[model samples]
Target: MVLCHDEIDAVNDMQNLVAAPSLRVTTVQQSSHTTLLLCSAYNFYPQQIQMTWLQNGEEVTSDVISTDVLSDGNIYYQIHSYLEHKPKPGEQISCMVEHVSLSEPLVQVWDPHPPRPLTERVKIAVGTFFLVVGLTALVVGIIKNKKRTAALCTVMHENLVAAPSLRVTTVQQSSHTTLLLCSAYNFYPQQIQMTWLQNGEEVTSDVISTDVLSDGNMYYQIHSYLEHKPKPGEQISCMVEHVSLSEPLVQVWVYFHCFDTGGVLLRVNIGALYLQSKVYRIGQLYMISKHSHEQSERGEGVEVVQNEPFEDPEHGEGQFTEKRIYLNNKLPSWARAVVPRIFYVTEKAWNYYPYTITEYTCSFLPKFSIHIETKYEDNKGTNDHIFGSEPREEETEVCVVDIAYDEVPERHYKESEDLRHFKSKKTERGLLPEGWMDTQDPIMCSYKLVTVKFEVWGLQTRVEQFVHKVIRDVLLLGHRQAFAWIDEWIDMTMEEVREYERATQEATNQKIGSFPPAISITETALPINVRNGPNSAPSTPLSTEAPDFLSVPKERPRKKSAPETLTLPDPGRRDSIFKLPSFFSWNSSPQPE
Candidate 1:
């Protein structure tokens, strides 16, 4: 059966086969040559292929290069060849490939031409003749058709500018129809009027708002809502208009329907078209409609399923967390009251120990017994009785009996009872006072009397008999505290010293005379003397020249003198006229003559 033209066209499109051979033609400019030619073919096998280059219908030799067959099972292959030198005059170079079921091999040819030579005078004469004739013809054409051509060209160019390029993005599809969203870009402002034309009439009711360009330039975009079940060969168009354009630009969008088992059968197809034979900027979007033909034939339907939820390990419940500490109670009431007082006394004793205690005695006897008596014989003698001694007569005698003694027992006593017995014996023999006793007693009297003695002895024994004796003493509580005060004082002093050093260094490093020298009284003494009392003449003015009239000094207003006092002559007596003496030389000289 003979197929219709559409069916034949479809069949030809389905063939999906193309073949091209590698054509290598070299063009050399005395010192340079072109590279090899590479070509490709579709729906062809290389093993069943033959490639060759023919020069003037003769097979090329070894000097002309060629490549091996490269292909897959499909109708696609590529190969390369090189020509060694530029072809001579009238030389024809062709690459040909042979295939099965093909009456003729595919051929591509490169024909080279030699340079033409002409005399300079003849060339100039020919150019002048052509120039005159071309100018005459151009002038005649313009005179004959100037207005018509200008109007036609203007209309054509305007139509090209207004022509719409359509693009459709297929958002989603349903069983009845495919949902398509269409957009157009690069449209001029004058061509922004858009309408959806169904069949031949304009569609105006279902229009959405148009989006104008934000830039001050001329451009706009508009969207329209369309719902239709498209069939094969159905025509739909998006038309645009602008007053500036001579003719309206129209873009026809053709719709096609296809069938698939899982989807509805609705498709829209669009291709670009030129108007007025001028170039137009067009964009297109296509939404393809699928039909459920196979499913309908088999009596089956397709279903969509939702995805399951996912759990992330990073957000799990049993993750590593930080711990915080909470304090349930503040300082105890007893401690709050006592700690401050204790700290104060201890601080005071540490500051004033040396000066407070002028004499101290430490003694150690048999059986590892130890005694220490600190006689804080105050310089003012307030605690002198505590040492069981009279007030000293002199300041120098206050420390006169300061003694420290240590005696290591041949054997150490294991228990406090043995130390007690030894201490009792020493007390009875007058080696120690009757009040002296071991410090291991709970009575207050025992502590006040003997605890001090034992502490002194312990310190002495540790110093002389034991491996370690660590002694730390300060003169007075105030003296120990003074050390801390002195440290602060030293720091402040050092800071002051450093600041002074920095100031001196800055002054030394600066350039000499960068600052004016300070005025001294001796240097400021004036060389010129004036009659004004006490005050000296003012210093020299900054400028050397006399000032202009506008800046000159002005005169001060003169003060009026008091009227002269007059006295009346006594009573009513007549006043005699007296004349002061003047030299009489002129009268005497006349008399002598």
Candidate 2:
């Protein structure tokens, strides 16, 4: 026992002797073509160490030189590494050091931008001196205005609790109607009232809302959805009454000619040439939608397995298209973990101009599907019973997304694309300032009724919620892109737009196919029922048989809830929706976004 204790003490003493490294990275030499960076580590003990260069998180294999660790003669060591490379735009260069003393790798980044010049530094110093002097004089002035300052503080305290941030966004859209979502977020005291008003009158019907819900941070959020069929010269807005505001806050809905699909309204200046605008916007939406799918780097991404645009006399007038978005590799990490590696979801759309019906179904899951009905109108979104005489489900959740005011992912943000700052020179429109919706002329809204279903018991709620989030993101991004790139498509003809879509879709399909795990194309006839008209949902499949990886498990049921042993749904059942197991009822209401 004494020997063991002595060994432990010796190890502890050795650990105590360890010294962590101090790193300094500098641009040692520079030329027009290449720059050399030197990274030095000082005063690190326990001689064994490793040093390397990294560019944007990846290891730098070439153009690297390292010096052997040298003793500092005071029980410490020093090492230096050199990296030489041509500078690339937006490339981050870093030096990584690993040693026995470090709990994790030590990194030092090289800043390409040089330190401030002496004159610039002197100017900043002078500015600071004047700023301090001004502050001192301001203090004297504040003493004379002490009573006024106190009154201002009292007003601030009375008004500055928490004011709700408001944004109106389109949750769903079709040919002639829009479903608008008005959301109020991050307010305190929990006493707030919201109302939808059209043309200065309080709207009484077709409004669905969520009760105020706590954000768990002493703040609350509520969402209200207004279904409206927009008309010419009509104004629609959300009125919020909160204690933080001295007066009620009003947010008007702005319907810009952001997208020019069939039923969407446009300014009369263009006259009958509006069809060109509609075609142009459709092309823009397709391109933007395609770009969103390419963000995933883990898999091959989305593939257009089949795209068939046809005309149906039964559906009346406009075009009908069936698109298959084969998402073999284009799935979120959470979904990809459980789904078969090779799977796809089918989309069928019946575009009848002012009204449209779109449906989504997954082949492998069989029980999961999404159905959406959309209508467009010339006024703010307010349309009730547009779908059918059937009463809409009261539990349906409405999410409003404001493209101009709502926050998008920071990585995707672009200054030129920001609606608050961007203005269209050709149309003399945009630069959408606060309350821009109140006065913007030629307004329209798209109303969409979305329904999602997942019959698997354990995964139903989670999957449905995830699908909604994904849908919202898609809608927000698509609308933002349409507005931002309006100039590119505002003048395109219908034929020109169709050609652009064809070329882009071909390029996108090629890009997905070129990725790892080579893909082969096969032709198979879809069921006749899949080609059936707009009223019925169809079970469409690219292939009849499941891949070998999707074969059922042989193990007997042992009370496990997984669907591994379950048989795939019969493709013959065309009209029947997947029913939930009687024991499992999904009563969970949708959460507000």
Candidate 3:
């Protein structure tokens, strides 16, 4: 029963026949210099209309009050809006009303200068009759008065509201401490509020804000500073509130943590992808921590080179380590044809239990990097604002990979690794049937934000897409294996797990290559595109020296088309997880107790 446009209009007409609104612009004396102006639209049909107050034909936003549409008890409505202002000479105030009944907006203007009293008019007429010869002198006086009125109006217009411009910057005070500055300028009115937020939570301590200062013009400016030590994957923002803005202005400052490993300074670029890990309680965390290490040690296609544990003043309570995953012969034939025989991707991680940050970088591709920020919680993946309140600059697309239902790669799939076929003997948590996610108990989810960047022009989109596929595969394979091999680490203590890491790291390093180089490396400024503006470089990471291993080859390899770039084989029955919509039903589930 779809109605045509004409029929819809006819129905609307029958329900709410056109009735234009009556508008009025009136003022009340508040003080000797101030006045309250009200612009009201009355008795409009359909209860929908718009009313705005304007000065000199420009719409006003500040010091305005409005009333909701009140019922006239006859199926009609009325609304009022007000603007309080100081009386200014030569200024024209108007009320603009818009409704469906009116062909165009109706504007009723109020004249500042009104007619004089009848006595004064009569006296002026008598004088004019007697002094007819002096009419030229009167006309010259009138022209001078008009010129003065125009000049006054120009000055009044200049003194109206001005919007503010905001800028945020970072300053490095020491190796680990950073200073963030948020500044807003060119705004009229001295009143403004500025505050600092870390991961969307306001920070009252260690924050300093300057008094709103005049800019010597008719505008105001203010500066806010936040002094802090660096932490992994922290988002700091400065929010400014002013009467000039209908909503508060927010400026985000993302903190990038840098640490030295061998002769390389690793700077992590932050990104996020929320992935679900359906497991019970602490078992989920242990499985993630231990299985990741075990997989690296057991893999044949890749080798784990260096695993160095380090201490940092900022992240003292957490585990800080650097690792290198050497990809020598693992590259596809097409990829191997265009690169050096020796190639590896560096992996640096800061593990703080449920909160962890891992970054991957390729020495050869200076413009490419992968950052992953992970947060573990004992609930369904519903905490949308766990990362930050402000929306990210990039559009976010969500992918839910059903480990049991989604198909796995043929070459890597194992009968033991299949979640639908394998069951755990000790925990009795295996042999997950179809739609098992609906009834899974004591569920926990791992929210991962994976950000990948490839700045090369033609290869950017395709390469990024491919890398995400590989990441999703890695996650899918790793989690599936974790559950299948749950008996291995379900009973290990924290100390035992640490000892296991030390032993396997040694064995893995021996299998990969010789000991890593120990040259000193200095921090460097990120590329201009990564920075917010010219002054965005924070003090701590002013500049970074290239790693020793990133030396230029004697010859440049010709660029080749990426393998499977033109057309990739269908991965599985389900579409690639990247192509999925923005959300899943499970994402809206209630927070787990």
Candidate number with greatest TM-score:
2
- For candidate 2, lDDT tens digit of each residue in 246-295? 99989888553322211111111111112232343353444444453444
Off by over 4 Å in 3: 1-316, 390-396, 513-593
Q: Alpha carbon lDDT of residue 463, candidate 1?
A: 21
* Candidate 1 wrongly placed segments (more than 4 Å): 1-170, 180-182, 215-218, 263-593
Query: Residue 58's C-alpha lDDT in candidate 1?
Result: 63
Q: What's the lDDT of the predicted structure labeled candidate 1?
A: 0.28
Kindly list the per-residue Cα lDDT of model 1 for residues 346-454, writing each as its tens digit: 0000001111111111111111111112222212222324434343322111010000011112231123212112222211311222112211111111001111111
C-alpha lDDT of residue 204 in model 1: 56
Q: Can you write out model 3's per-residue Cα lDDT over 1-593, one digit (the tens) per residue?
A: 44544456777766748688998776654447656566767777877888877778876544444555655545567776655577778888888988899889999997555555479789899888879858877888889777665544434444467778886655432343455667788887767888888888889876656556655456777776666665645666788888779998876664433222111121211101112332232344344444434444222212333222323344433444445555546655656675577666665555555555665566566655555556666555555555553333222321334566555778668888787788777766667765454445433556655444433433433443455345445556656766776777667655565555555555555544463552111123234354222222111211223443442232432122212111121222111112111100001111111
**Cα deviation of 21, candidate 2, in Å:** 36
Residue 534 displacement in candidate 1 (angstroms)? 99
- Estimate the lDDT of model 2: 0.55
The TM-score-based order of candidates, best leading, equals 2, 3, 1
| RMSD, candidate 3, Å | 24.4
